[model samples]
Target: MNEPLCPAYSVLRLLSGKWKPAILYHLREGSLRFGDLRRSLPGVSQKMLTAQLRELEADGVVVRSVMACVPPRVDYALSSLGLALLPLLQQMDDFVQENREFFPSEEG
Candidate 1:
């Protein structure tokens, strides 16, 4: 069946994962090793982080590079496609700050 397409849906779909947003935010700065990335996002299990990274890599949003060394270290960075999302994410951050009253914190 043919269905009407919504542009924003695609963007939303790409970022629907719980960890995707945070992952992108962290990668916005630059590349990070698996261990460092894991440390940045506390409470995230290794399995979950691996899965999320694979998804982002598959989506062409993240670039996974393996170093040719004794330990064979791997680093994850955002591709050009992922970089495009930075501005949008910043806008969302700004919106949240502007309307903080709409969102309540636990310590309210």
Candidate 2:
């Protein structure tokens, strides 16, 4: 019989995508327009970014707001839930940094 997934697994699933953690990390500073976020993450495709943002918004981890303007602008920011996750993300970053020698360098 199959057992239910653990709470940690659920959290992992919510932030599983390659770009989700980075997206959250960038948003930790403050809200950013869609174009700005896209520019910040160089390798992400527009379509992928859109999809990920939508997923995050749906998951209640990110908030998307539309501003009235000549051309309507959309901005993304971390929700309370997302903010709560920052410390965990930072801990993960700290662990990885502390064990840097175990991981392969990006230059390889």
For TM-score, the strongest prediction is: 2
Candidate 2 least-lDDT 10 residues = 1-10
Q: What is the lDDT of candidate 1?
A: 0.93
Clashes of 2: 0
lDDT of 2 at 86: 97
lDDT of 2 by residue, 1-108 (tens): 555476688789779899999999999999999999999999999999999999999999999999999799999999999999999999999999999988778777
All candidates: TM-score: 0.91, 0.93
The residue-level lDDT of candidate 1 at 103 comes to 73
What would the C-alpha RMSD of candidate 2 be, to one decimal place? 1.9
Distance from true location, Cα of 75 in model 2, Å:
0.5
Over 4 Å off, model 2? 1-3
Write down the lDDT that model 2 would get. 0.94
RMSD of 1: 1.8
In candidate 1, the residue pairs with backbone N, CA or C atoms under 3 Å apart (3 or more residues apart, or in different chains) clash, namely: none
